[model samples]
Target: MLDAHLVKNLPDFKIDVNIKSAKGEVIVLFGSSGSGKTTCLDMIAGLVHPDSGHIRMGENTYFSSNQKPFPAEKRNVGYVMQDYALFPHMTADRNVQYGMKSVGKSEKSLALLDQFGIRHLRNAYPHEMSGGEKQRTAIARALAAEPNLLLLDEPLSALDDKARHDALTVITDIQRDLDIPIIMVTHNWTEAEKVATSIYKIEKGRLI
Candidate 1:
């Protein structure tokens, strides 16, 4: 299980939200822009330190006000950012291989590409691929690291209707296959209803 209580004082408002999800659950933080949804993910992913509260996944304590904050690199978090964030210069396969820690990185990356039905684009760079392809590549790269938890920030926001549908299926499949907790942030009500096992609505910075 993943449990977090994040408290951060932003200039506009303070973020104070508690989040919890078990394995195989897709928890969506549904909110408008600047509602602090992404900030919650950042704290859980170790990218941002909360002013107080704790982040714990199973037996691992990622952060706490009293203890030292865990280093981000060691957190083993798989994050698919809002923009996909694929390296412009790297090929799809190489980008996937970038986060892998296992042996046979090339083979693993290829397998993931195949799984995502983007094997044909393995050699293509981010600029050469469409938005959907880049999104799939980003997801593949995030999973290549075999993280304990997954964080997705508006993952399907850039896709067309068909692509969005396809990506939604892929996300569901991934959650079922990996049996890990997934925290996704999105403002789209339809998308949230489609993917979330549980939804938390946020306004300003508080869960409602």
Candidate 2:
């Protein structure tokens, strides 16, 4: 299970939230802009620290008020940022291989691309790919690291109607295959309803 209770004082307001999700579950943090949804995901991903609280995945304690927080690199989290965050200069295959620790990185990257149905774009750079293609590559790269948790921030916001539909299907397949806790942030209720196994609505800085 993934469990977290986070408290952070922002310049304008305080963020306080408690969330939990079991394996194979997709939890949507549904909220509007500045509702602290991204902050929650950031804290969980170890990119931001909480004022006081705890974060845990199964038996591993990622953060606590008393103990030193675990380092972000060691957290083994796959984070897909709002922008997709793919390296502009790197090709699809290279981007996928960037975080992999396993041998035969090339082979594994290709396989992952194939799994996402983008093997043909292995040599294409981010600029050459469409929004949907870039999203798929970003996701495939995240999975390449074999993370224990997945964090997605406005993942489908960049895509058009058809692309969004295709991306949603990809996300569903990922959740089913990986069986890990996926915490996704989105302001769209319709998107949240389609992808979430459970949803937590946030308002201001708290769950509403």
Q: Please name the candidate that would achieve the greatest TM-score relative to the true structure.
A: 1
Once fitted onto the true fold, the runs of candidate 1 whose alpha carbons sit more than 4 angstroms away are none
Expressed as tens digits, the lDDT of each residue in 70-166 for candidate 2 is: 9999999999999899999999999999999979999999999999999999999999999999999999999999999999999999999999999
Question: Clashing residue pairs, candidate 2?
Answer: none
What's the residue-level lDDT of 108 in candidate 1?
Answer: 91
Candidate 1 local lDDT, 113-196, one digit each (tens): 999999999999999998899999999999999999999999999999999999999999998899899999999999999989
Model 2 residue 134 CA deviation in Å: 0.9
Model 1, position 187: C-alpha lDDT score: 96
Clashing pairs in 1: none
C-alpha local distance difference test of each model = 0.94, 0.94
Output candidate 1 Cα RMSD. Answer: 0.7
Give the runs in model 2 whose Cα sits over 4 Å from its true position: none
